[model samples]
Target chain A: MKRSFYLKIFLFVVLLFSSALADAAEVYYLGGPQGSSQEAAVNPSYSLKQRFQDLFSSLSSIRKDPEASGSISGHLSQTVVHNDIGGNREKSYLKPGVNYITDLNFSIQEKLHADYNFTGQWFLRKTDDPRVESRRDVRLKQVDLQVANERNLYQFGDFYGSFSQFVLGSSLEGFNMDINPTDDQHYQIVIARRNEADTVANSFQRNVFGFKADRYLFKGSDLFSDFRIGVQAASSQDDSASLPDNHTAKDLRNTVFGLDGEIVFKQGLSIQYEYAGSAYVEDEDASEKTTTYANAFRFQPSMRLGKANVRYLYYYAQPKFYTDAGSSMSDKIQNQVSLDYRFSDRVNVTVSENYYWDHLKGSSRTKRTFNDEKYMTWNLLPLASRRSFNLRPYVNYQVRNSDDPGNSAESTTLTGGFDISDRLNAHTNWGVGYECRSFIDRVTRSNSEIFHRIRFNWAQDMMLWARRLYYAITPNVDIRHRKGNDNKDVTVGAGFNVQYDLFQRVFLRMGNTLADTNSASPSGDYVNNRGFWEVDFLVDKERSAHFIIRGERNNYTAENGAQSYKEQRVIAKFEVNF
Target chain B: MRTKTIIAVLLTSMIVVGCRAVTGAVVDRRAVAQESLFSLAGTLIKDLFDNYQDFSMESFRAKVAVDFVSSRNDLVNNAASNIRAAKVLDIDFSLDQVLSDKDLLMVDLKWQKRTRPYDSSNVVLTEGFTQAVFKNVAGQWLLYQINKDNPF
Candidate 1:
């Protein structure tokens, strides 16, 4: 009797909440790395991310004017993660990290054309334990400030609107140094629970200050056109201190200056130019200088045809003295041209080409003793062709010239893809490239590769009372051939991911991938299999408050050996934006 | 489960058939309207560029400046919106007739337009445009393709 009564109450509450959601606006939330989202095994689920925005806006409106309405919003996201790998080695870790961001924003404007706006945000972050390397704890804190003054102007020839004709800004940021991920030698990546005494921790403090100014030259449509120019200056200070009180490092100072300008020609030819430079200073033994610059020009003769773009740039950097003694001074020049063509609604193509020439002058010690100086003389140029069909199918090809030393001897790559029917898609690519003459003699290598992929996708928004599921099957094969070597390898892989949205704000996802490779070995033949698994669960109360738990496991097995690794992480986030 | 699958397919087919009927009519209208717009915009641009001597930088600037001042006044008085000025102010210099076959028309347009600076006191122009296609639909003109470089 008690269980039945509880069940009845739950059903009633669910019905009431769902009815409320049916009347709210719909907004989809897409969160992923690198500004793009991946397809899931289940259909795309729509979340009420938009409803939150509408709710906030309405709340602000209700409290407007008489109340001078405003809202302070923030988000706190923290993750606890663990990783495990075994080989008779017992290792454990409890790494914890938290990122909290808060912003204060408000606006007050009168009937006048001028207004003042201010926005500020604070970001605080801390990492307690690092996995790849031994580290105790690190923290970073930063603050941003933005203020602008805008006014209505009738001086610009044909433009209409109020502009921020002038502005001023400054900021301060600092963080504790941690591990470097780009390039770490084998000696730096060791993590052993049994050897805690040999581990060391080091950290650094950094700060930066900056300022900027902008101004307009004239207004109105004239043969001379409208113009604007901006200038900025910034500087940073770095101080490092290692553990065990070994030594106190000198402060490193860096300064940068920049300038930018834009011009509109009466003939519709618009040109823009910008330049920036930086200088670094440290102890007499470890100081260096560097600079970078770029220029671009575009033209459109009429409205029907597209624009033609041309760009050129040069960059030079001199090697440092202490740690980079035998290094060389490097210089690089690049040129590019592109044209956009629109044939019709269903067809379009863009043609582009890029050429680069680089030179390195060996240092005195390297010039006399090292053979690298002879290898420094080289150039590289690549020609690219691209075409798009019906906005859904596309093809691209690239050819390279290799006589320039740094370039491949002769190489060509082609990729073509199409959507077959509504549920199937396929892509294929192949490339053949040769090693430069210099490397050909030593490595004696030429390479050929072929890749093919096909995927089938099916999704529906409505299924079994608002529940949605999306699924896809992707299979790919890659074949590689090498010269001077009788052995070759072919690899085939497939992956699938799916999300099942249950009720209003609860969901679960599961994904897996498998890869198999067949290789002709020096002794005979070999096969390797690699697979991975992923699972995640999430819940949101109001779209602004959320909780997520995710885990991944990967395994690799071969005829001779096998290895398995796993990771688990959980994150809780909440925010309210106005 | 098999019955459910059949029902789902039947429902989707019904919806698709309904959509197709409506789309068929729209396609015909769009085809004609797009053709007409393309022809008019293309021809105008080509004629302007062909007589570039009459529309030199000095003359063009003078005309735009005068027109801008008047438009600004009208906007302040709430008599007009910025769109009116934008339409009258669009100027293209690179004009080439690339397609005039069949009943459809296509042309490439490359032109530069000066924009009002954030301060409104200064003007900066950027040069850009597109090759556009037009089709006449239901006695109305519509645009199909618009790009900076020549498409066809």
Candidate 2:
């Protein structure tokens, strides 16, 4: 009788929550790295993050004053987390947290003549484990300051620079200056010490120094039509504790010279080209030395019609094109052609094809393992108003072909999806979507795959106080046919998530997902389930308090093998914004 | 053995470097928009050179500084936001026209932009047959308007 009485109270509390909805602000980003209930997974405490900003707002009247030309805004959060992962390698962790963090930007400016801006972030963090001293420290993530005007700009602190498409752009700490004596021409000088971000947890630090100069030449007169050219020379050296990597130690000194240009003959036509040559000198094993050279180049031409933009590109890079570390460019031979068009205000389409001739930096480049891909995609928007009937549709098709010397294969895929939404009233909304994908291969066309998915979403607001509710559910069906047999494999999945604002600043959220797979051949069968429950309470607009619990389970049985895996975790979080 | 070891190290380094490039691309896509906040003049240049991205129509329309023209020009704002990022640092530019006044100035420039990451070199070399009108507001120069110009 006593147990039954307690159950009645529990049921009553659940029934009360059935009428609530989650605060959209706290749950806007649901699918980031840590999955749902982000507060419990990534940041255990951010509600207190608001206190720092509140304290400073009063102190720095300059920050809040409307008359001031500059404004500063940022968020600070502190978290404590306890996590456990259950499986073959079971483990648990306890963290005490970051002492403080600041993502702040401050800027001051004068009239049209000049302005300066500074932005940076800092964090102080530590763990509860006393045995690991290295797990605790204060880290500075970013700091950049710039002063600029109409013709020239100077920058100091942390910044990235690149010359041409491939060479340069290593994150560094230093100074850069741009001089523009004329409107058509400019010169740039860069000097910096490469400050690698990964050095925070690693045993080795690379102290590389870099310097480069770039000159740009162009003419804008109709007599000359269109023209552009860029020339650059850069040098860098690795001046670090050259510790042995893979039982081999080497120090590198590299230099690169590059030139790139473009010319437009008419309104719709243009051509572009780029080339960079890199020379490397490596000193290894005390007295041994080796030298190598690499070259990179690209050529592209494009045309624009009334509704379409078309372009063709060819790129080539040798294995050793990168000196120390490159930012954007890669070592490969590639060719591509693409077109984009807008059929109407509500519809757009894009078609593209890409071919990769070789991966020069891979295990083998001379093997001639070539691959190509073609793609077409369309997007449409048919919505009349934010609260009226709305429709959105998307479709995509792609094909990939590969020739790896003696072996050849091809794959084709097509997918389409659409969402329809309607407003039932002033305070309620409903939406539904359906999507499907079909996949097939050329060599063994018998092995094919198809997938279908459907989802429903809704939100409601109650007139009583500031309360809201949101819910969504999705179901997926997948089928894959066997190549040699008439049998096939099938899997089905369904998941739902709900959020409720129980009070003025408190919320409750819960979600569950489950999937099952069955095979006619009896060699592949499995079931997977995952779920999470959470409660978040807001102290203010920028401060929140939260707790969460999560669990997952997977079981598989087949003629080839049988296995099971399961895990559970709990978290508490706080946040503050200033 | 030495040659093999060298090859392994080189391969590993390349993998790490390659991964960083792709990762940075993803990071840029996911970065908070606050860092790239709007400025009357910088917004246009920001869309052309530095980590270029489309701005909301409201922001573009409101930022249009030309008091004589319609600030809510959806076509201009849309076209401005649609400008693609340069593929490389290759740029050609020339100042073809400029009209100067005490409170306002109009200029016409032309150039070709390539596909590449944000860099000062590109900024210094960017080209397009662009018509930009600047106006002085409280002693600050703001991007007043932009118009299309014939390239040839």
Candidate 3:
């Protein structure tokens, strides 16, 4: 009777959000630990893998009732890893021990309008280590209740915000607002302790208050239409004053302010810009005040000319230009131009150029410049429609100058490759292709390299399983002359990959790569290379059960210690959903 | 030096414009606020990848105050000021996921950027995810915000 009552209650909750697909409340913020067993301790923010686990758990809960709205899911997964980084075979006791991980997620969302939600996770895992320390842990990954309406969003417990690029997007306990009083503008406000989500309290979990406002200007004007301008300000106080980084709470505070905008012309031209400035509170005993600034800018123009579309772009970013939430676009400037033309029936061409400069922040180091060129595959594609075989050929070239940013060294490379495939019967096909590349580098002058590769692949589709196999062979030579030294090196390699399925429930995948290098020199020269082989067998049944056995080997050889290794690993995993 | 560089660029642009005029193929395109959400979202990405101006690179960002963000253009120029020309590498614009409701459209995008540094000849690959949100305004969709949720 108790079991039936619980089931009925679950059904009632699911019925509440049955119509969620049509006009669902947004999940603007879902914050928790985002890391793997290998990365969780060091990563302060929740991980992507964790999010997927949470989603699957929610899905399981939804399966109970078609109209179910609550979030509760059970999960079980295990992985074991063995590694040996030391080269000594006799030291059996020193071999790395196995590592294991398992977790469970329970999430709930209760919404009459689903304008609000209560969701969290209970995660447990264990790590094995013979030398250092093993960890057996259980923690609340997150427990947060969220409420949202047309103009407001509120969350308690654990949450994060995505307000602006310069603003901290850190996980914390906070109240946030996504308020829109007027149609043309909106505002976001966040007040939380950054790094508070760390399983262990961080020494610098500062309390930060941030707000941002955006105003859309000139709703429908040609030049001004769709233009968005935003301003933001944030200040953080040393919430953990007892820590060493902020003893007495004097030297550990900061203020950030920024402005960003984009103006677009209907004529396929645009200008985008961002600026961020951060001021750090200085200790009373410090000698100088420290402040940092960063910026990003881009210009793009695109057009259709005759029968082709042409685009040109230039990008620039300052080194150390830090935005707490922005992608790293620092220390480099780049330019890209491309022209893609499609001719009536027999002709198609794509041409593009890319150039970049790195090390702009170095005061004394010269900058390095790179140039890349792509001339699209001259595929006799029309023949494919009228004939049994099609040919596609392409060229790639690159020129790099200096390891240092300036005129210290240079390297140039070019390649030409092609692919042609024949359609054999209804279920089988095979293709073969080859390419050659030449490279030359002159740090102090005198280096030459040439390489060639051949690739072939076959595939067949029949019964309930599809099978495919691909292989490639590559050979290369390199010669270097410096002052009184001369060295010659040659390398040969091959690779194979295969995939097959049996009974529609079992899958097999495998790949192998082998390479060898030979070097001769009067002064001193060494060659190094790596060979790898991996295979996996998976059994998946009706998406309910999954099992996989995987093994991998990495063998490395080198005359010099620059690179050398030999390692092997095997893994078995099983997963099921109820 | 900066002034000279700017002047040189302007001169080069004029020459290019003159050539386009001679061809009589220079067409005008405009994206006002009348576009739908999908069109508007696509334009935001297009503007971001195509614009070459330092300031134009910021065109896709919301036009509101974003405290302490270094202007993307300035950052680029600072990184490679001597570089007067550039070209984008293999970048694929894929809208991997989309969610929409009455007044909002949220999109998960995968942007693959392959490029050589302004002064180097080696390519660097920075692939990441960005979440973009669009809001409906007066029967038109406009980009409201962008967050870089890149996988580190």
Best by DockQ: 3
A347-401 per-residue lDDT for model 2 (tens digits): 6777767667555664244455455555555555556354376665555455555
- Candidate 1: Cα lDDT at A403: 37
lDDT of 1 by residue, A60-131 (tens): 442333212222333345454444433211111222343222222222211111122232334344444332
lDDT scores in order: 0.32, 0.47, 0.47
Say which prediction, candidate 1 or candidate 2, comes out ahead on DockQ: 2
Ten-residue stretch with the least lDDT total in model 1 chain A: A181-190
Instruction: Name the better of 1 and 3 by DockQ.
Output: 3
Candidate 3 per-residue C-alpha lDDT over B59-148 given as tens digits, one digit per residue, 9 for 90 to 100: 222231121122222333232221122112224454433434345555556665543232222334456767665556666555544556
* Candidates 1 and 2 compared by TM-score, better number: 2
Give the 10-residue window scoring lowest on summed lDDT in candidate 3 chain A: A27-36
- Candidate 3, residue A68: CA error in Å? 2.6
User: For each model in turn, which proportion of the native inter-chain contacts is also found?
Assistant: 0.00, 0.00, 0.01
Better of 1 and 2 by lDDT: 2
